[model samples]
Target: MGGTFDPIHNGHLVAASEVADEFSLDEVVFVPTGQPWQKDEVDVSPAEDRYLMTVIATASNPRFHVSRADIDRKGPTYTIDTLRDLREAYGPDTDLYFITGADALEKILSWKDADEIFALAHFVGVTRPGYELSAAHLPADTVSLVQVPAMAISSTDCRARVAQGKPVWYLVPDGVVQYIAKRSLYR
Candidate 1:
Protein backbone atom coordinates (compact mmCIF):
# COMPACT_ATOMS: atom_id res chain seq x y z
CA MET A 1 0.00 0.00 0.00
CA GLY A 2 1.54 3.32 -1.05
CA GLY A 3 0.83 7.00 -1.74
CA THR A 4 2.23 10.50 -1.32
CA PHE A 5 0.06 10.43 1.86
CA ASP A 6 0.62 14.12 2.55
CA PRO A 7 -1.15 13.94 5.88
CA ILE A 8 -2.31 10.37 6.44
CA HIS A 9 -6.04 10.90 6.83
CA ASN A 10 -8.88 8.62 7.93
CA GLY A 11 -9.90 7.70 4.39
CA HIS A 12 -6.44 6.33 3.70
CA LEU A 13 -6.48 4.30 6.91
CA VAL A 14 -9.98 2.91 6.37
CA ALA A 15 -9.35 2.02 2.74
CA ALA A 16 -6.02 0.36 3.48
CA SER A 17 -7.44 -1.56 6.44
CA GLU A 18 -10.44 -2.76 4.45
CA VAL A 19 -8.19 -4.05 1.70
CA ALA A 20 -5.86 -5.79 4.13
CA ASP A 21 -8.79 -7.35 5.97
CA GLU A 22 -10.54 -8.47 2.81
CA PHE A 23 -7.43 -10.16 1.50
CA SER A 24 -6.31 -11.40 4.94
CA LEU A 25 -3.07 -9.61 4.30
CA ASP A 26 -0.16 -10.21 6.66
CA GLU A 27 0.70 -6.54 6.97
CA VAL A 28 0.13 -3.30 5.12
CA VAL A 29 3.38 -1.42 4.69
CA PHE A 30 2.47 2.20 4.04
CA VAL A 31 4.97 3.62 1.58
CA PRO A 32 5.24 7.38 1.34
CA THR A 33 6.27 8.78 -2.02
CA GLY A 34 9.24 11.20 -1.90
CA GLN A 35 8.77 13.55 -4.86
CA PRO A 36 5.32 12.78 -6.14
CA TRP A 37 4.86 13.05 -9.89
CA GLN A 38 1.53 14.87 -9.49
CA LYS A 39 3.17 17.43 -7.19
CA ASP A 40 3.59 19.66 -10.25
CA GLU A 41 -0.13 20.44 -9.92
CA VAL A 42 -0.36 20.60 -6.13
CA ASP A 43 1.66 21.34 -3.00
CA VAL A 44 2.26 18.55 -0.52
CA SER A 45 3.00 18.90 3.15
CA PRO A 46 6.70 18.29 3.72
CA ALA A 47 7.84 14.66 3.24
CA GLU A 48 9.26 14.48 6.78
CA ASP A 49 6.00 15.77 8.21
CA ARG A 50 3.90 13.43 6.13
CA TYR A 51 6.11 10.50 7.12
CA LEU A 52 5.92 11.49 10.78
CA MET A 53 2.15 11.80 10.64
CA THR A 54 1.85 8.37 9.08
CA VAL A 55 3.94 6.92 11.87
CA ILE A 56 1.70 8.53 14.48
CA ALA A 57 -1.56 7.61 12.73
CA THR A 58 -0.85 3.91 12.34
CA ALA A 59 0.83 3.40 15.69
CA SER A 60 -2.00 1.39 17.20
CA ASN A 61 -2.31 -1.05 14.33
CA PRO A 62 0.01 -4.04 14.70
CA ARG A 63 -0.56 -4.95 11.06
CA PHE A 64 0.43 -1.54 9.75
CA HIS A 65 3.99 -0.37 9.12
CA VAL A 66 5.70 2.50 7.27
CA SER A 67 8.29 2.22 4.51
CA ARG A 68 10.76 5.01 3.72
CA ALA A 69 11.95 3.41 0.49
CA ASP A 70 10.69 6.18 -1.77
CA ILE A 71 11.71 8.91 0.67
CA ASP A 72 15.19 7.42 0.89
CA ARG A 73 15.40 7.25 -2.90
CA LYS A 74 15.57 11.07 -2.85
CA GLY A 75 14.12 11.63 -6.31
CA PRO A 76 10.80 11.56 -8.09
CA THR A 77 9.09 8.55 -6.52
CA TYR A 78 8.12 6.24 -9.32
CA THR A 79 5.62 3.53 -8.38
CA ILE A 80 7.38 0.92 -10.46
CA ASP A 81 10.70 1.60 -8.80
CA THR A 82 9.18 1.32 -5.35
CA LEU A 83 7.45 -1.91 -6.30
CA ARG A 84 10.63 -3.31 -7.74
CA ASP A 85 12.67 -2.41 -4.70
CA LEU A 86 10.03 -3.77 -2.33
CA ARG A 87 9.84 -6.91 -4.41
CA GLU A 88 13.53 -7.43 -3.94
CA ALA A 89 13.53 -6.37 -0.28
CA TYR A 90 10.59 -8.52 0.71
CA GLY A 91 11.87 -11.40 -1.42
CA PRO A 92 10.04 -13.54 -4.00
CA ASP A 93 8.05 -15.51 -1.42
CA THR A 94 6.22 -12.49 -0.08
CA ASP A 95 2.88 -11.58 -1.60
CA LEU A 96 2.88 -7.88 -2.42
CA TYR A 97 -0.23 -5.76 -2.80
CA PHE A 98 -0.23 -2.26 -4.29
CA ILE A 99 -3.14 -0.15 -3.12
CA THR A 100 -4.39 3.05 -4.77
CA GLY A 101 -7.57 5.01 -5.57
CA ALA A 102 -10.07 4.58 -8.39
CA ASP A 103 -9.13 7.83 -10.14
CA ALA A 104 -5.56 6.59 -10.29
CA LEU A 105 -6.70 3.31 -11.81
CA GLU A 106 -8.52 5.24 -14.52
CA LYS A 107 -5.26 6.86 -15.53
CA ILE A 108 -2.96 3.94 -14.76
CA LEU A 109 -2.10 3.64 -18.44
CA SER A 110 -0.26 6.92 -18.42
CA TRP A 111 2.09 5.95 -15.56
CA LYS A 112 5.75 5.32 -16.25
CA ASP A 113 6.21 1.55 -16.62
CA ALA A 114 2.53 0.86 -16.13
CA ASP A 115 2.65 -2.64 -17.56
CA GLU A 116 5.47 -3.72 -15.28
CA ILE A 117 3.64 -2.47 -12.22
CA PHE A 118 0.67 -4.69 -13.01
CA ALA A 119 3.03 -7.60 -13.59
CA LEU A 120 4.72 -7.02 -10.24
CA ALA A 121 2.02 -6.91 -7.56
CA HIS A 122 -1.71 -7.30 -7.00
CA PHE A 123 -3.44 -3.90 -7.22
CA VAL A 124 -6.35 -2.73 -5.09
CA GLY A 125 -8.42 0.33 -6.02
CA VAL A 126 -10.33 2.36 -3.43
CA THR A 127 -13.29 4.43 -4.67
CA ARG A 128 -14.90 7.46 -3.15
CA PRO A 129 -17.71 9.65 -4.46
CA GLY A 130 -17.05 11.42 -7.78
CA TYR A 131 -14.73 8.61 -8.81
CA GLU A 132 -15.75 5.30 -10.37
CA LEU A 133 -13.85 2.41 -11.87
CA SER A 134 -14.97 1.72 -15.37
CA ALA A 135 -13.64 -0.96 -17.70
CA ALA A 136 -11.51 1.67 -19.40
CA HIS A 137 -7.73 1.13 -19.48
CA LEU A 138 -7.60 -0.84 -16.21
CA PRO A 139 -4.42 -2.86 -16.06
CA ALA A 140 -5.25 -6.30 -17.39
CA ASP A 141 -7.15 -8.21 -14.67
CA THR A 142 -4.75 -7.50 -11.83
CA VAL A 143 -6.70 -4.58 -10.39
CA SER A 144 -9.59 -5.26 -8.00
CA LEU A 145 -11.98 -2.85 -6.25
CA VAL A 146 -12.33 -2.75 -2.47
CA GLN A 147 -15.27 -0.74 -1.14
CA VAL A 148 -14.88 1.10 2.16
CA PRO A 149 -16.46 4.17 3.78
CA ALA A 150 -16.21 6.89 1.17
CA MET A 151 -14.59 9.57 3.35
CA ALA A 152 -15.30 12.91 1.72
CA ILE A 153 -12.61 14.53 3.86
CA SER A 154 -9.40 14.74 1.85
CA SER A 155 -6.08 15.92 3.33
CA THR A 156 -6.51 19.14 1.32
CA ASP A 157 -9.96 19.64 2.76
CA CYS A 158 -8.68 18.91 6.25
CA ARG A 159 -5.86 21.42 5.76
CA ALA A 160 -8.38 24.00 4.62
CA ARG A 161 -10.53 23.21 7.62
CA VAL A 162 -7.56 23.76 9.91
CA ALA A 163 -6.61 26.98 8.13
CA GLN A 164 -10.14 28.25 8.55
CA GLY A 165 -10.16 27.36 12.25
CA LYS A 166 -12.76 24.70 11.58
CA PRO A 167 -12.69 21.26 13.16
CA VAL A 168 -10.57 18.55 11.52
CA TRP A 169 -11.38 15.94 14.19
CA TYR A 170 -13.22 13.56 11.87
CA LEU A 171 -10.88 13.92 8.95
CA VAL A 172 -7.75 12.30 10.34
CA PRO A 173 -6.53 10.40 13.39
CA ASP A 174 -6.60 12.50 16.54
CA GLY A 175 -2.86 12.19 17.02
CA VAL A 176 -2.24 13.25 13.42
CA VAL A 177 -4.54 16.24 13.79
CA GLN A 178 -2.73 17.27 16.95
CA TYR A 179 0.67 16.84 15.30
CA ILE A 180 -0.43 19.00 12.42
CA ALA A 181 -1.62 21.62 14.89
CA LYS A 182 1.53 21.42 16.98
CA ARG A 183 3.65 21.89 13.88
CA SER A 184 1.34 24.69 12.68
CA LEU A 185 1.07 22.86 9.37
CA TYR A 186 -1.34 23.82 6.63
CA ARG A 187 -1.60 27.31 8.08
Candidate 2:
Protein backbone atom coordinates (compact mmCIF):
# COMPACT_ATOMS: atom_id res chain seq x y z
CA MET A 1 0.00 0.00 0.00
CA GLY A 2 2.94 2.31 -0.62
CA GLY A 3 2.13 5.48 -2.54
CA THR A 4 2.81 9.16 -2.58
CA PHE A 5 -0.56 9.53 -0.78
CA ASP A 6 -0.41 13.20 -1.73
CA PRO A 7 -3.57 13.19 0.29
CA ILE A 8 -5.20 9.97 1.32
CA HIS A 9 -8.64 9.46 -0.18
CA ASN A 10 -11.53 6.99 -0.31
CA GLY A 11 -10.25 5.08 -3.31
CA HIS A 12 -7.05 4.20 -1.45
CA LEU A 13 -8.85 3.19 1.73
CA VAL A 14 -11.51 1.21 -0.10
CA ALA A 15 -9.04 -0.69 -2.24
CA ALA A 16 -6.69 -1.44 0.65
CA SER A 17 -9.50 -2.50 2.96
CA GLU A 18 -11.02 -4.65 0.25
CA VAL A 19 -7.71 -6.41 -0.28
CA ALA A 20 -7.17 -6.89 3.44
CA ASP A 21 -10.63 -8.34 3.87
CA GLU A 22 -10.32 -10.53 0.80
CA PHE A 23 -7.00 -12.03 1.90
CA SER A 24 -7.54 -11.75 5.66
CA LEU A 25 -4.31 -9.82 6.01
CA ASP A 26 -3.17 -9.03 9.55
CA GLU A 27 -2.69 -5.35 8.84
CA VAL A 28 -2.41 -2.94 5.93
CA VAL A 29 0.48 -0.50 5.87
CA PHE A 30 -0.02 2.94 4.35
CA VAL A 31 3.43 3.90 3.10
CA PRO A 32 4.06 7.46 2.01
CA THR A 33 6.56 7.66 -0.82
CA GLY A 34 9.66 9.70 0.03
CA GLN A 35 10.35 11.08 -3.43
CA PRO A 36 8.44 9.42 -6.20
CA TRP A 37 10.58 8.67 -9.25
CA GLN A 38 7.59 9.41 -11.47
CA LYS A 39 7.16 12.85 -9.99
CA ASP A 40 10.76 13.96 -10.41
CA GLU A 41 9.72 16.60 -12.90
CA VAL A 42 7.18 18.25 -10.62
CA ASP A 43 6.92 19.41 -7.05
CA VAL A 44 5.10 17.16 -4.63
CA SER A 45 3.49 18.10 -1.39
CA PRO A 46 5.94 17.85 1.50
CA ALA A 47 6.38 14.41 3.05
CA GLU A 48 5.50 15.62 6.55
CA ASP A 49 2.16 16.99 5.43
CA ARG A 50 1.37 13.90 3.38
CA TYR A 51 2.25 11.66 6.33
CA LEU A 52 0.08 13.68 8.69
CA MET A 53 -2.88 13.48 6.36
CA THR A 54 -2.37 9.76 5.91
CA VAL A 55 -2.31 9.31 9.69
CA ILE A 56 -5.49 11.34 10.11
CA ALA A 57 -7.26 9.50 7.30
CA THR A 58 -6.49 6.06 8.68
CA ALA A 59 -6.88 6.88 12.38
CA SER A 60 -10.36 5.39 12.56
CA ASN A 61 -9.37 2.07 11.04
CA PRO A 62 -7.66 -0.27 13.49
CA ARG A 63 -6.60 -2.52 10.61
CA PHE A 64 -4.70 0.29 8.91
CA HIS A 65 -1.48 1.95 10.07
CA VAL A 66 1.09 4.34 8.59
CA SER A 67 4.70 3.36 7.82
CA ARG A 68 7.51 5.92 7.83
CA ALA A 69 10.12 3.80 6.05
CA ASP A 70 9.68 5.47 2.70
CA ILE A 71 9.52 8.93 4.20
CA ASP A 72 12.70 8.38 6.18
CA ARG A 73 14.68 6.95 3.29
CA LYS A 74 17.32 9.39 2.08
CA GLY A 75 17.30 8.61 -1.63
CA PRO A 76 14.78 8.06 -4.36
CA THR A 77 12.20 5.59 -3.04
CA TYR A 78 12.15 2.20 -4.70
CA THR A 79 9.44 -0.39 -4.21
CA ILE A 80 11.96 -3.19 -3.69
CA ASP A 81 13.70 -1.28 -0.93
CA THR A 82 10.43 -0.45 0.75
CA LEU A 83 9.27 -4.05 0.52
CA ARG A 84 12.61 -5.32 1.85
CA ASP A 85 12.50 -2.97 4.81
CA LEU A 86 8.92 -3.95 5.56
CA ARG A 87 9.77 -7.64 5.33
CA GLU A 88 12.59 -7.15 7.82
CA ALA A 89 10.39 -5.17 10.19
CA TYR A 90 7.52 -7.61 10.05
CA GLY A 91 9.78 -10.66 10.15
CA PRO A 92 10.44 -13.21 7.38
CA ASP A 93 7.20 -15.16 7.73
CA THR A 94 4.86 -12.22 7.74
CA ASP A 95 2.30 -12.40 4.94
CA LEU A 96 2.74 -8.98 3.45
CA TYR A 97 0.85 -7.62 0.46
CA PHE A 98 1.65 -4.48 -1.48
CA ILE A 99 -1.35 -2.69 -2.97
CA THR A 100 -0.87 -0.45 -5.98
CA GLY A 101 -2.82 1.21 -8.76
CA ALA A 102 -3.28 -1.09 -11.73
CA ASP A 103 -1.82 1.54 -14.01
CA ALA A 104 1.46 1.48 -12.17
CA LEU A 105 1.58 -2.28 -12.39
CA GLU A 106 1.34 -1.91 -16.15
CA LYS A 107 4.67 -0.14 -16.12
CA ILE A 108 6.52 -2.54 -13.82
CA LEU A 109 9.13 -3.44 -16.44
CA SER A 110 10.52 0.07 -16.27
CA TRP A 111 10.98 -0.01 -12.50
CA LYS A 112 14.46 -0.60 -11.09
CA ASP A 113 15.21 -3.99 -9.55
CA ALA A 114 11.67 -5.09 -10.30
CA ASP A 115 12.48 -8.79 -10.27
CA GLU A 116 13.48 -8.72 -6.60
CA ILE A 117 10.15 -7.12 -5.74
CA PHE A 118 8.21 -10.15 -6.95
CA ALA A 119 10.05 -12.31 -4.43
CA LEU A 120 9.44 -9.85 -1.61
CA ALA A 121 5.70 -10.06 -1.13
CA HIS A 122 2.36 -10.35 -2.86
CA PHE A 123 1.22 -7.51 -5.12
CA VAL A 124 -2.43 -6.47 -5.10
CA GLY A 125 -3.50 -4.32 -8.00
CA VAL A 126 -6.51 -2.08 -7.49
CA THR A 127 -8.31 -1.80 -10.79
CA ARG A 128 -10.02 1.40 -11.67
CA PRO A 129 -11.72 2.76 -14.80
CA GLY A 130 -10.07 3.25 -18.19
CA TYR A 131 -6.54 1.90 -17.72
CA GLU A 132 -6.51 -1.87 -17.61
CA LEU A 133 -3.26 -3.63 -16.72
CA SER A 134 -1.93 -6.42 -18.88
CA ALA A 135 -1.24 -9.39 -16.64
CA ALA A 136 0.91 -10.87 -19.38
CA HIS A 137 3.60 -8.24 -18.74
CA LEU A 138 3.67 -8.43 -14.96
CA PRO A 139 6.97 -7.85 -13.20
CA ALA A 140 6.48 -11.25 -11.63
CA ASP A 141 3.96 -13.99 -11.21
CA THR A 142 3.55 -12.98 -7.58
CA VAL A 143 1.25 -10.25 -8.83
CA SER A 144 -2.26 -10.99 -7.62
CA LEU A 145 -5.31 -9.23 -8.94
CA VAL A 146 -8.10 -7.86 -6.79
CA GLN A 147 -10.64 -5.94 -8.82
CA VAL A 148 -11.97 -3.21 -6.60
CA PRO A 149 -14.56 -0.87 -8.03
CA ALA A 150 -13.14 1.81 -10.28
CA MET A 151 -12.77 4.81 -8.04
CA ALA A 152 -12.53 7.27 -10.89
CA ILE A 153 -11.31 9.87 -8.48
CA SER A 154 -7.58 10.44 -8.22
CA SER A 155 -5.38 12.69 -6.07
CA THR A 156 -4.68 14.89 -9.06
CA ASP A 157 -8.36 15.23 -9.81
CA CYS A 158 -9.18 15.99 -6.21
CA ARG A 159 -6.47 18.61 -6.10
CA ALA A 160 -7.72 20.21 -9.28
CA ARG A 161 -11.34 20.25 -8.14
CA VAL A 162 -10.23 21.72 -4.83
CA ALA A 163 -8.19 24.39 -6.57
CA GLN A 164 -11.22 25.27 -8.67
CA GLY A 165 -13.44 25.52 -5.56
CA LYS A 166 -15.33 22.42 -6.50
CA PRO A 167 -16.91 20.14 -3.94
CA VAL A 168 -14.62 17.24 -3.11
CA TRP A 169 -16.74 15.74 -0.34
CA TYR A 170 -17.96 12.88 -2.51
CA LEU A 171 -14.52 11.87 -3.68
CA VAL A 172 -12.80 11.46 -0.31
CA PRO A 173 -13.54 11.02 3.39
CA ASP A 174 -15.00 14.11 4.99
CA GLY A 175 -12.26 14.32 7.59
CA VAL A 176 -9.58 14.05 4.92
CA VAL A 177 -11.24 16.73 2.87
CA GLN A 178 -11.35 18.94 5.94
CA TYR A 179 -7.69 18.34 6.59
CA ILE A 180 -6.86 19.38 3.04
CA ALA A 181 -8.93 22.52 3.39
CA LYS A 182 -7.38 23.40 6.72
CA ARG A 183 -3.94 22.95 5.29
CA SER A 184 -4.88 24.51 1.92
CA LEU A 185 -3.42 21.51 0.14
CA TYR A 186 -4.53 22.21 -3.41
CA ARG A 187 -5.18 25.91 -3.08
Candidate 3:
Protein backbone atom coordinates (compact mmCIF):
# COMPACT_ATOMS: atom_id res chain seq x y z
CA MET A 1 0.00 0.00 0.00
CA GLY A 2 1.50 3.34 -1.09
CA GLY A 3 0.33 6.72 0.16
CA THR A 4 1.65 9.93 1.58
CA PHE A 5 0.34 8.76 5.01
CA ASP A 6 0.92 12.21 6.45
CA PRO A 7 -0.59 11.09 9.75
CA ILE A 8 -1.51 7.46 8.98
CA HIS A 9 -5.12 7.22 10.12
CA ASN A 10 -7.49 4.36 11.00
CA GLY A 11 -9.08 4.47 7.56
CA HIS A 12 -5.74 3.47 6.07
CA LEU A 13 -5.26 0.69 8.59
CA VAL A 14 -8.77 -0.64 8.04
CA ALA A 15 -8.37 -0.63 4.29
CA ALA A 16 -5.09 -2.50 4.51
CA SER A 17 -6.52 -5.00 6.96
CA GLU A 18 -9.59 -5.61 4.84
CA VAL A 19 -7.55 -6.02 1.68
CA ALA A 20 -5.05 -8.29 3.35
CA ASP A 21 -7.82 -10.52 4.65
CA GLU A 22 -9.68 -10.67 1.32
CA PHE A 23 -6.56 -11.37 -0.70
CA SER A 24 -4.77 -13.61 1.80
CA LEU A 25 -1.75 -11.38 1.62
CA ASP A 26 1.23 -12.41 3.74
CA GLU A 27 2.16 -8.81 4.46
CA VAL A 28 1.18 -5.22 3.78
CA VAL A 29 4.04 -2.80 3.51
CA PHE A 30 3.10 0.85 3.87
CA VAL A 31 5.35 3.03 1.76
CA PRO A 32 5.21 6.76 2.48
CA THR A 33 6.17 9.12 -0.30
CA GLY A 34 9.30 11.26 -0.18
CA GLN A 35 7.76 14.02 -2.31
CA PRO A 36 4.38 13.44 -3.88
CA TRP A 37 4.44 14.80 -7.39
CA GLN A 38 0.68 14.90 -7.71
CA LYS A 39 0.38 16.84 -4.45
CA ASP A 40 3.10 19.37 -5.12
CA GLU A 41 0.68 22.25 -4.78
CA VAL A 42 0.24 21.55 -1.09
CA ASP A 43 2.89 21.97 1.58
CA VAL A 44 3.38 18.35 2.59
CA SER A 45 4.88 17.41 5.92
CA PRO A 46 8.47 16.23 6.03
CA ALA A 47 9.03 12.71 4.70
CA GLU A 48 10.59 11.59 7.98
CA ASP A 49 7.54 12.74 9.92
CA ARG A 50 5.15 10.93 7.57
CA TYR A 51 7.31 7.78 7.66
CA LEU A 52 7.40 7.79 11.47
CA MET A 53 3.65 8.30 11.70
CA THR A 54 3.09 5.38 9.31
CA VAL A 55 5.42 3.25 11.43
CA ILE A 56 3.48 4.16 14.56
CA ALA A 57 0.15 3.43 12.90
CA THR A 58 1.19 -0.01 11.59
CA ALA A 59 3.57 -1.12 14.32
CA SER A 60 1.09 -3.39 16.11
CA ASN A 61 0.17 -5.47 13.06
CA PRO A 62 2.62 -8.37 12.70
CA ARG A 63 1.75 -8.63 9.02
CA PHE A 64 2.16 -4.91 8.44
CA HIS A 65 5.53 -3.23 7.92
CA VAL A 66 6.94 0.15 6.84
CA SER A 67 9.33 0.70 3.96
CA ARG A 68 11.62 3.65 3.24
CA ALA A 69 11.92 2.92 -0.48
CA ASP A 70 10.00 5.95 -1.67
CA ILE A 71 11.21 8.19 1.19
CA ASP A 72 14.82 7.30 0.46
CA ARG A 73 14.54 7.83 -3.28
CA LYS A 74 15.34 11.29 -4.59
CA GLY A 75 12.95 13.38 -6.73
CA PRO A 76 9.20 12.97 -7.06
CA THR A 77 7.64 9.74 -5.84
CA TYR A 78 5.87 7.72 -8.55
CA THR A 79 3.95 4.45 -8.35
CA ILE A 80 5.97 2.86 -11.13
CA ASP A 81 9.26 3.37 -9.30
CA THR A 82 7.82 2.00 -6.09
CA LEU A 83 6.59 -1.15 -7.87
CA ARG A 84 9.90 -1.53 -9.64
CA ASP A 85 11.89 -1.25 -6.43
CA LEU A 86 9.69 -3.78 -4.67
CA ARG A 87 9.98 -6.13 -7.65
CA GLU A 88 13.76 -5.93 -7.41
CA ALA A 89 13.70 -6.56 -3.66
CA TYR A 90 11.17 -9.42 -3.74
CA GLY A 91 12.41 -10.95 -6.99
CA PRO A 92 10.71 -11.05 -10.39
CA ASP A 93 8.63 -14.16 -9.66
CA THR A 94 6.97 -12.75 -6.56
CA ASP A 95 3.37 -11.67 -7.03
CA LEU A 96 3.11 -8.08 -5.84
CA TYR A 97 -0.12 -6.14 -5.44
CA PHE A 98 -0.31 -2.38 -5.53
CA ILE A 99 -3.16 -1.41 -3.25
CA THR A 100 -4.58 2.07 -3.54
CA GLY A 101 -7.78 4.02 -3.01
CA ALA A 102 -10.28 4.13 -5.86
CA ASP A 103 -9.67 7.82 -6.40
CA ALA A 104 -5.98 7.26 -6.98
CA LEU A 105 -6.59 4.27 -9.16
CA GLU A 106 -8.73 6.39 -11.43
CA LYS A 107 -5.71 8.49 -12.17
CA ILE A 108 -3.40 5.57 -12.87
CA LEU A 109 -3.34 6.17 -16.57
CA SER A 110 -1.97 9.64 -15.98
CA TRP A 111 0.89 8.42 -13.82
CA LYS A 112 4.43 8.10 -15.11
CA ASP A 113 5.12 4.93 -17.08
CA ALA A 114 1.49 3.99 -16.69
CA ASP A 115 1.50 0.97 -18.96
CA GLU A 116 4.66 -0.47 -17.48
CA ILE A 117 3.21 -0.20 -13.98
CA PHE A 118 0.74 -2.99 -14.71
CA ALA A 119 3.58 -5.31 -15.68
CA LEU A 120 5.31 -4.75 -12.32
CA ALA A 121 2.39 -5.55 -10.02
CA HIS A 122 -1.31 -6.22 -9.93
CA PHE A 123 -3.46 -3.26 -8.83
CA VAL A 124 -6.04 -3.42 -6.07
CA GLY A 125 -8.45 -0.53 -5.91
CA VAL A 126 -10.21 -0.29 -2.56
CA THR A 127 -13.46 1.64 -2.27
CA ARG A 128 -13.39 4.98 -0.49
CA PRO A 129 -16.23 7.29 0.45
CA GLY A 130 -17.30 9.61 -2.40
CA TYR A 131 -15.34 7.53 -4.89
CA GLU A 132 -16.86 4.84 -7.05
CA LEU A 133 -14.96 1.59 -7.43
CA SER A 134 -14.92 0.75 -11.11
CA ALA A 135 -12.39 -0.89 -13.43
CA ALA A 136 -14.06 0.36 -16.60
CA HIS A 137 -11.10 2.54 -17.42
CA LEU A 138 -8.44 0.09 -16.27
CA PRO A 139 -7.20 -3.20 -17.63
CA ALA A 140 -9.51 -5.89 -16.29
CA ASP A 141 -6.84 -8.55 -16.04
CA THR A 142 -4.42 -6.53 -13.89
CA VAL A 143 -6.88 -4.72 -11.63
CA SER A 144 -9.21 -5.79 -8.87
CA LEU A 145 -11.87 -3.65 -7.19
CA VAL A 146 -12.74 -4.27 -3.55
CA GLN A 147 -15.48 -2.72 -1.45
CA VAL A 148 -14.07 -1.99 1.97
CA PRO A 149 -16.17 -0.60 4.81
CA ALA A 150 -16.90 3.04 4.33
CA MET A 151 -14.32 5.26 6.04
CA ALA A 152 -14.94 8.96 5.59
CA ILE A 153 -11.77 9.91 7.43
CA SER A 154 -9.01 11.54 5.39
CA SER A 155 -5.52 12.88 6.02
CA THR A 156 -6.67 16.35 4.94
CA ASP A 157 -9.44 16.26 7.52
CA CYS A 158 -7.09 15.06 10.23
CA ARG A 159 -4.65 17.86 9.48
CA ALA A 160 -7.42 20.42 9.52
CA ARG A 161 -8.70 19.09 12.83
CA VAL A 162 -5.25 19.35 14.35
CA ALA A 163 -4.62 22.84 12.95
CA GLN A 164 -7.97 23.97 14.36
CA GLY A 165 -7.12 22.55 17.77
CA LYS A 166 -9.80 19.90 17.56
CA PRO A 167 -9.37 16.33 18.83
CA VAL A 168 -8.66 13.53 16.35
CA TRP A 169 -8.88 10.68 18.82
CA TYR A 170 -10.40 7.88 16.75
CA LEU A 171 -9.75 9.28 13.31
CA VAL A 172 -6.19 8.01 13.48
CA PRO A 173 -4.25 5.53 15.57
CA ASP A 174 -3.59 6.53 19.18
CA GLY A 175 0.15 6.42 18.66
CA VAL A 176 -0.23 8.70 15.65
CA VAL A 177 -2.22 11.20 17.69
CA GLN A 178 0.53 11.29 20.29
CA TYR A 179 3.25 11.47 17.66
CA ILE A 180 1.54 14.36 15.88
CA ALA A 181 1.22 16.24 19.17
CA LYS A 182 4.83 15.51 20.06
CA ARG A 183 6.15 16.61 16.67
CA SER A 184 3.85 19.65 16.39
CA LEU A 185 2.82 18.60 12.91
CA TYR A 186 0.07 20.24 10.83
CA ARG A 187 0.26 23.35 13.03
C-alpha TM-score for every candidate: 0.95, 0.95, 0.98
Q: Report the Cα RMSD per candidate.
A: 1.2, 1.3, 0.8
Q: Candidate 3 — worst ten consecutive residues by lDDT sum?
A: 128-137
lDDT of 1 by residue, 1-187 (tens): 7777778898999999999989999999999889887766878878899899999999999999998899889779888999998999999999888998887777778889988888899888888777867845675578888888877757778878888999888789999889988999988
For residue 21, give model 1's deviation from the true position in Å.
1.2
| lDDT to native, each model | 0.85, 0.86, 0.92
Best by TM-score: 3
lDDT of 1: 0.85
Compared with the true structure, model 3 gives a TM-score of 0.98
Candidate 3, residues 16-124, lDDT tens digits: the string is 9998999999999999988899998999999999999998888888999999999999999988889889988888778899999999999999998999999888899
* Cand. 3 Cα-lDDT: 0.92
For lDDT, the strongest prediction is 3
Clashes of 3: 0
Clashing pairs in 2: none
Instruction: Enumerate residue pairs that collide in model 1.
Output: none
